[model samples]
Target: MSAQHFVFLLVKNHTHLTLACATEPLRIANMISGQELYRWSYASEDGVSATASNGSVTLVQHGFGALPPCERLFVIPGLGMTDFITAPLLACLRRAKAGGVAVGALCSGAWILAEAGFLDGMKAAIHWEYHDAFAERFPDVALVRSVFVADERHITASGGTATADLMLHLIEQDHGYDLSIAVSDMMVYAGAREATGEQRISLQSRHGMRNPHVARAIAIMRGALEEPVPPGSIAEDLGISVRQLERLFGRYFNTSPSRYYMELRLDRARNLLLQTEMSVSEIAVACGFQSLGHFARLYRKHFGGPPSSQRGRIA
Candidate 1:
């Protein structure tokens, strides 16, 4: 079979994990199959290098001014994605689509594709962290909460290991199940996750709480992490008395509503500390803790270290 060429357009601060997961599958497939089944290259805006969120850099072989024809062109973006979606980037994607190339996005790369109008009127997936903002920005795009979306013309993955799932699906589509499985085994990947798999764990799965009211309450808390609603207000919204809500929480979670809310916010703060470059104070405010001193105390108690220390370890 002829090699199916894939070109990845790397934007500044692209997620390193997503880029590796997207390309490594193809490389392993070729090794396992003993054929040049896939060919890939990287591109940037001006033939320069692109840096990832983790501070690593990738050198590009092509620029938007000289995009190579390929079976697919993926826009791989990460932090500050809005700043990278310049007019030239959008035009390059548009031109690729017009020239009959399949256009795709990995992670926040969907933001650029949507800006280029490629995802308009189509179902798409992006990194869960960007979902709320992406939905607000691209109202015309039907955003799904899946790990990835493989629509007829537009392909998208929610980033991270989900990019591997998308690539395995494509391998299965092109070759067969056995070869895809072989490639997955070679990479020690736990088989292929369906495109329909969710990017975020459901509340019930996360907390093992099954009661309907408890589930609804937890969902509300997650949605309002930055500005938590009072427990009484949550009970009121659910048309239940505060006592009933408290009983439900104690029954399922064995904790008070306010405590549970604090845990949720703390969990989010921990993730931001590890995965993003947000300052401790900024993360505290974003996670609904107004007092920096108070936030530091709670964070140390919960995570066994200060938020700044966690960020330092990650760095």
Candidate 2:
């Protein structure tokens, strides 16, 4: 079989270590085998040298202006992608997609790609810290906070070690298990994980409320974020008085139930703004607001801007 090939896209303020974690495995795999199992080159926008978040810079072999044909093009943008989404970059991505270049992303690069209209209707895994914003802005794109995604032609992943895992999966796919294991052993990785390993913190523990009643109430509230139930109703359904409900929230979270519910709605709204392409009116309606004016006012009061403006700046 021919050697697997890739083109890695780097950007300013990228996580340099993550880049090494991703590409070094391929190098090790090639070293282990007697043939060229993998080959790759680095590329950047405008063909300029790319810098990492930690102040290191690397000169690439070619710029996005004149990329070499490769099996895959993995975009590895990091912080400040909100500023990185330019007409030229987006046009380059569009051209690449049109030219049949299989595309992928890492870290906030997913945000950049979606802004360039590459991720519509596709399920993506992105850095969890950006999930709220990503999901909020790109509702059409299914957002899974996992290590990586490889179900179809695209292969986006979250941050840091997730990049390593994605590369290991690629190695395993190109070579067999033995070569993959050898490469993994060369790096001293504990072991290769199945693709579904956890990417973000699990919800079962975030609640910290072992009381089933409180858990049920919180879950219900999360599910019904748009049309929030009155805290009193929640207490009543949980077979507790309003005072008791207040005591539970106070004990567990040091806050009021109404406040908790309000925060949850706003949080959901924030995510919609950053991740989905839904209009502000649509997001407000989905989050349970009947009055667009009221939703905009409240959103401004909570997040320092109206929903539309926030999504515009971020997405």
| Alpha carbon lDDT of each predicted model | 0.87, 0.79
Error of 2 at 295 (Å): 8.8
For model 1, the superposed segments whose C-alpha errors exceed 4 Å read 210-213, 216-246, 253-315
- Residue-level lDDT of model 2, residues 26-52, one tens digit each, is 889888897787888888775868988
Q: Number of clashing pairs, model 1? A: 0
Residue-level lDDT tens digits of model 1 in 1-315: 799999999998889999999999999999988999999999988888888989998888998878987999999988878777787788888899889999999998888888877778999998877764565568899998999999647999989999999999999999999988988998888746898988888778887756789888888998899999999999999999999999998988799999999998998887777655667888898889999999999999998988888773222
Estimate the Cα RMSD of every predicted model relative to the unseen true structure.
Answer: 5.8, 4.6
Model 2: CA > 4 A from native: 191-193, 205-220, 229-259, 266-315
TM-score on alpha carbons, each prediction: 0.74, 0.75
Instruction: In angstroms, give how far residue 226 of model 1 lies from its true place.
Output: 14
